[model samples]
Target: MDVRVTDDADVAGAADETRSLLAWLTQEDELRGRVTPQERPPVPGTLGPVLDGLVVALGSGGAVTGLTTAVVAWIRSRHSDVTVKATRSDGASLEISTKLVGPMTPQELRAFVTDSSRLLEGGQGGQGGPGPDGGAL
Candidate 1:
């Protein structure tokens, strides 16, 4: 999975922020060996060098759940608006926003997870629950 992180103009350190997120995920017991920094070609953006993205190795059963949980929590812990996009090799992907996940209810969160799991696991299309405001990819 290619995990991309983006932040608002006020927090233009998206690449740096992604690195921090990598650290956070690395510390999670469930995500320890699953998270690793990956490279993306530099683009014209103030976000800097395009030196971001985490290539998470997601296996079956609960792997997506733990990854998303850790990711959402990391986003919420931040003050700036940060968004995440998780995409599988099959091109199925989803994007979630910190603004959306911060106030999400359990049901909404479940929907996000269900939607994430489906995409991350190689499925595509309609989501079973309310998805993240960041929209689908």
Candidate 2:
């Protein structure tokens, strides 16, 4: 899957901030051996200029839940004024956009990511309890 994160800070600093966030995200343990950086192009359906963004290619077996949770938490911690749009795509696609204004603890972020991941994987029944690999939330 490919994950893209765009930093929507002011135009003057958006590019640099996005680059820095991308570099930091690449070093995360959850992304280790899985994420590769890519250039940002103009969004396919928009007329806007090339966005100040970063792209990460995730290995097929990478842990999406862990990686997404960490990335969102890190971005929120560093850039409260910036809006972030994180998009994950394989055959199916998921996109989450947010600007961190109110308080969101790390635990809450993890739970949110876990639930989102489960839903993405088509496990929305809410009764299975565990994932396909026999892992509980």
Candidate 3:
């Protein structure tokens, strides 16, 4: 998973905010054992270790769900105007991508992340349940 902030007046400050958000995410109970923050290489134009984004590795299949929810909620609360993108790959062909544009309540955040995760997993809110008229139940 990775998060980057865009459309901010202070580029450096935005980077700092991203770092702060990353720290908060790392501290979340949902991600405590499931996500690991990775060291970022220096940027080409930057002089030091300042980063515009953060990258974390998810531990298991379920980790993606937790990490995504945590990241979106964090960003929504901290920097509502900033754009954030979180990406996760399974070391093969599967990859999960999530984007947030602005502030979202916990309920909205959960719904968004759940929908995205479902799409990424090639499903829509898990297996289809019984529908009206008793068809495709």
Candidate 4:
């Protein structure tokens, strides 16, 4: 995998996040087989004012791993001020190019609700009811 950050005019924190993301990808077991970033040019137009950047993930082999979950999780976990858009090279193999925006997407809001619901469902005490002493609430 080759991840690059071609913009630097945004908040310094954004650049740091790109670095951290690349590091995490290289270190994670699911992504350890990938390669480090190839190029990270600073695109003045892309990053400026509030904060934003361009992120591209490239794959060299037949199939890649740690992408779907990683990408979605990263998007779902980002701050409210950040926005991410992922596009595949050919709508397959999970290759993605992401552009961050000052405002988040409406889809992100839907995802948040869905994730919260899932969490709530999982947090439920299970199928069986509680025992005599308020064992499960």
lDDT of each: 0.68, 0.56, 0.48, 0.38
lDDT tens digits by residue: candidate 1, 63-108: 7778877877888788888777766665545666776788888777
lDDT of 2 by residue, 1-137 (tens): 56665656787788677777766776777776555445556668966454456666555444666565666666666734665555555433334334432254656555666765664454443322222223443
Best prediction by TM-score: 1
Global Cα lDDT for candidate 2? 0.56
How many clashing residue pairs are found in candidate 1?
0
Off by over 4 Å in 2: 40-51, 60-62, 90-102, 119-137
Whole-structure CA lDDT of model 1: 0.68
| RMSD of each predicted structure | 4.7, 7.4, 7.9, 13.9
RMSD of 2: 7.4
Decide which is better by TM-score, 2 or 4: 2
lDDT of 3 at 82: 52
Model 2 earns a TM-score of: 0.60
For model 2 the local lDDT of residue 131 reads 26
Error of 4 at 75 (Å): 2.6
What TM-score does model 4 achieve against the real structure?
Answer: 0.37
Worst 10-residue stretch by lDDT in candidate 3? 128-137
For model 3, residues 1-137, the per-residue Cα lDDT tens digits are 43222224266476666666667767877666443344456789857665545555444466556655665556556533554444334322222222332534556545666655443344433223212222222
lDDT of 2 at 71: 60
Q: Which window of 10 residues has the lowest lDDT sum in candidate 2?
A: 125-134
